[model samples]
Every structure is written in C-alpha cells, then in structure tokens.
Target: MSDAYVALEGGSVVAARCRAPGTSHGELVFTTAYTGYEESLTDPSYEEQVLTFSYPLIGNYGVRSERFESGRVHPRAVVARELTDDVAEWLTEEGVPAVDRLDTRDLVGEIREGGAMKCGVSAGPDASPEDAKAALAECPGMSDYTDIGAQVSVSAQKTYPGDGDADTEVALVDCGAKESIVKSLVERGATVHVLPYDVSPGEVSDLAPDVLFISNGPGDPANFEAAESLVSEFVGEVPLAGICLGQQIIARALGGSTAKMDFGHRGVNQPVRDLRSEKVVMTTQNHGYTVADPGDLEVTQVNVNDDTPEGLESDDLRVLTRQYHPEANPGPNDTLGFFDDVLDMVDCRTPVAAD
Candidate 1:
C-alpha cells in the first residue's frame, strides 16, 4: 500500500489523505468522544473545520448506516491517531469510507498552541503534506463559518410523519438539522413542516404553526441575517425553541452574544446543570461556537465543566434554547424532557380522555 500524506501545523498533523477534494478549510479542532463518530461527522456545527479524534483507536467499532444525522458526511476533514485495517462489519454494511490516520498527538499539540487553523486531508502521492499545511495555515478561521448554515441547509421544504390527528403544528427551520429532533417533535403529537434555513419569519408564519422550532446546524449564527430577523420577529408573537446553532441564533435575537469556544465541546457525555431545577444532566454535544455572553436572555442551564452557558430562555417571548443536544441519540436521556418543556411553552395542551 502507498503511504498517505498528512498536513500538520506546529508539529500536529491536522489533515490526512482521502478527505473530500475542493473543500474549503478552517481551523482544525479535536473531540474526545470515544463513540458517535458518525454523528460528529454529519453535525452541521463542524461545517468549516476539520476534526481530530483524541481517542487513540478509531474505526474499530465502525460506522452504522442507520445512525446518520444528516444526508451526507459534512466534516471538512477527519483525522485519527491510528486507523484499523479490521474495520467493523457495520462499516461494510453502511458503505462509508474508512478515515485516514495521522499523528493525533501532534495535531492536538498544534491546535493547542496555535489556537486553531484551517486544514485539509486528501489522498495520493502527489498530495504534499507541506503544501497542504501551508495552504491551510493561510486560510481564514471561524469568521467564514457564519455562512455555513446557508451552504448546508435543505434546499427545499419537507415534512415528517407525526402522531395521528395531532392538533399542534410546528414549523421547523432546518439549519443542517438532524432527523432525530424532528422525530422528537412528531412523537410529541405535533405536525411538523421542515423548511430551509434561510426561510423568513413571514414564510413560516404562513404555515400557521403553533410553535416555531430552529434546529441545530453548522456555522456561525451571526451570518444568518434573515434567520436572526425571522426568529426575532417570531419571538413573543409565537412560541419558539432551538438547539445548538439554533440556540445561539435565538440568543442573538434576544440581545445575547455568541463566541467561539477555546477547543469546543464534542462528545456524548458532557455534563450540564439546569439552573432552574439544579439538576445535572449528561448530554451529547457537537459545536465549535457557543453563547459568548447572554446579555438579556436568562441563562437556564450551564456547563458543569467550564461554566459556559448551556441553555437560555426569554420568558417574556416564550423562547428557549440549549447549547447542547437534548435529543441525543447515542448519548444521555436526561434532557429529553426539555423537548416536552418546549411543547408546554407553546400551550399545546394534552387532550383529556372522556371520563
């Protein structure tokens, strides 16, 4: 077998061979999760960046076809410390390519020292590691990530099956959204209409939904000018809820601010505490940006590790959001009730059976 070239900055190999060609680059970040590699790759929040796995071994358990959050692989690049030849049987079933391996410790050290930089991974002997590293180093950072939601958002409208005869209708804005979030709304007896990320509030208002939902996605929320306005207009006029990128957008609408994290939280076991209930919940998280300073929005939940804002609410507008995934698939179930809370906020009363 021929050797693959990997790009490194400050001695860390941030990109490896076989990543998608002609892809834009950004700072490479690392995630410590031992599992959920599939979910991580498809997450929109990693839109402009490459990802490095801190776990020593990857592709051991392999990829699952049934576990995809989005329609395609969305990461700019994926780097691992070691690659296993004996990929799991599930990977063969799924038909996803095995990730190229590189020196992860070196990559981690580079990101830690340099703070983060754009990088790429590709295959072939002609792929020069030095050239790729230099190209990536010169590329811009997270500022470009602002436009990521528009790039990855659904191009057309869509819908999902819900419980029979549901009274509540929900209009969900897809910002590179995951299917599970739609499933949660459906299970709660809601008729869901999925729209593109750039849809305006007036467009969604035409749907006459009882509640508006902003799904988690990739990129910086500040760049979504229309979305910010739409969300802001809908606040108080109708019930609203959001997660991940959606969360940040809602905060922005409510006069809050978001900032890029030092390293970002990407795992299935991140712990968050509910300031309202004073309960700690382990959650699935995948995002490079977070609410920098929640100016007017009331902070409801906070990360236990770094005290970063995890959840926020504007009671006056009936708007609520979370920086982490409450619909975690391969992660914890502690925050699942948060979805129920969303339904309740929208005043979707449960029907009482005849006595």
Candidate 2:
C-alpha cells in the first residue's frame, strides 16, 4: 500500500512510496539531467519548488558533502521513480520530504502539457490524499513568494580570498549563489566579496570592486529590487556580469522586460548558439523566467531550441550576462569560457566596437 500522496494543481492525486516522511508544498518542476543529483539538490535555484527527476534511478553513486552546491537542500520536496537510501536518508535528515516509486514518466508528461504548477506532498505512514490536497490548497504561487531572496541568501557579508595572486576584486551580490561560483572566481585569481541580496549601493561603492556580479537566484526577477538597483547603480561605472537569474535581473534594471516561461529550461544539455559566430554549445540551466526585451543590451547568443536570449552583452557598458550556468558542476564545460569573457571586461573600461 502507498504511504505517500502527491496532490497536483489539476486535482489529481498520485500515490507514491514514502522515502522521507513530511508534508510540503511548492511549484512542481522536472529536470532531465541524468547525473549530478547531489549538486542539483543543493542548488539555491530550486528554492520553493518540488523537484522531479526525469531519470529513473537517482543516487546511484551515493552522496557526498563536497558535491553539494549549498549548505542545505533547496527544494521543498523531491519526486522520483526510485531514490536510493543515501539520498532518501539525506533528505530525511534535512527535513525535506521525498516520495518515489511513482510513474515519473507520466508525471513529467503532465507537467509538459500543463506547465509548472502548484503541488503538495504528504508522506509518512499516515499520509493521506486529503492531507496533500490541503497543503496544495494553501500553497502560494511562485510569484507570491516576494521574500524568497531572504530565504536563500546570506544575511551578512563574507569574503573568499583568491587561490593565487588575487589580481582582481569582485563584489558579488548573493541573491542565492552557488559555492561553485565562488570557487570558480577564486580559481581565476579573483577575491570575491559575497554581499547580501538586499545590500545598498553605498555598501557596494565602499568595496570599489573591479567587477560587480549578480549571482543566480530563485523567484521572479521583479522581486529582487535590490539586485536590480545595484545593476542600475554600477552599470557604466563598474564592469558587470551575471548568470541565470543574474542575467534576468541585469536586463530588468536596464529597461529590459522578463516574462515567465511555460516550463523553464532545467537540464544539463541545453544547446545555445552565438549569434555572431553561429557556434553552438551545450549548457546547464534552471530558470522559470526568460528575457522578453533586451532594452539597451545587445543579444550575443540564444537558445537553439526556442531562440530565447541566452547571452546578453554590451561592449560599451562593459556588461555581460548569460541565462545558463557556466560553472559546469553537473553540466558540460563548454561555457566555462564565459567567465573569461566576463573577467576580460575589467580591462575594457572604454567602449570598443562590437566584434
């Protein structure tokens, strides 16, 4: 007999095995990535969401703390066809709900047809369909979580010294940054100062950083007014860079508009093409919003599948942004050069002709 019940927005209740006991609610979304379960689970971008693994078996390689992106699991709950004991135990210890032994293929199909929607999960020996439905009824939509940044970002400023000589300084506004992003910059000889999401412009000006970076985060871009304000404040003054939601925030601050995607890209092998060179590369992505209008920035690259803006750059303003993750924790290393491009902007203070 099933010990877990999942209530979807459409009124359908799916019975599943209880891997970890708890009750939770969030927006239900799926990821097609076949590996990197550990990194994906810890990603701050998964905040306020129920993550469903499209792959059948998860935790084949067991779990390790070194593979974690953040200090804790970000997803409110997890759904899968089968979850190994290691992952299940980890989720239980983290106080996050986990349910498996369900027809994930069918559930994924439903999400594709209906888009990401509100979901509720009730798991444990005493779990009931009514319990899950009750959670679902009370669950707020993603946009309604106006204070989501506070849930994932750091409360105080922290700094990580660069690995080597530490030539450049980067002031990173941590909306919800991944540890890998810090490591990536440190490895590149950059001293990274991670600041709070709601930090003021005066606080940033105190640092006098060579580059102002906005880290990837969760929730609607419009909600991160502080990060957007930072973007506007330092647009022409400091070289700017961002990734994932960082890209969306930069666009919004510069008069660009962002809209919700039907089902945002959440996988390892998303193909992106450069408009200038027409070169293609696979990237890792996890976002529910897309840039609709680029405002003053020039579109440098786009997703091959839907032609959405994937890379936004402005040589004049020394601003660079990407809609995909270039840190390549669980994805391809194809876009690692993105960091190089962003760091290069430090030397290009004066505007140059678009190449």
Question: In candidate 2, how many Å is residue 244 off?
Answer: 0.6
10-41, model 1: which lDDT tens digit per residue?
44443444422333345678887887777776
lDDT of 2 by residue, 129-207 (tens): 9999999998998999998999999999999998887578889999999999998998898999999999998888787
TM-score, cand. 1:
0.87
lDDT score, residue 318, model 1? 78
Worst 10 contiguous positions by lDDT, candidate 1: 88-97
Q: TM per model?
A: 0.87, 0.98
Off by over 4 Å in 1: 8-24, 85-101, 348-355
Q: What's the true lDDT of residue 197 in model 2?
A: 97
What is the alpha-carbon lDDT for the whole of candidate 1? 0.72
- lDDT score of residue 141 within candidate 2: 88
Clashes per candidate, residues 3 or more apart or on different chains: 10, 0
Candidate 2: 10-residue stretch with minimal lDDT:
346-355
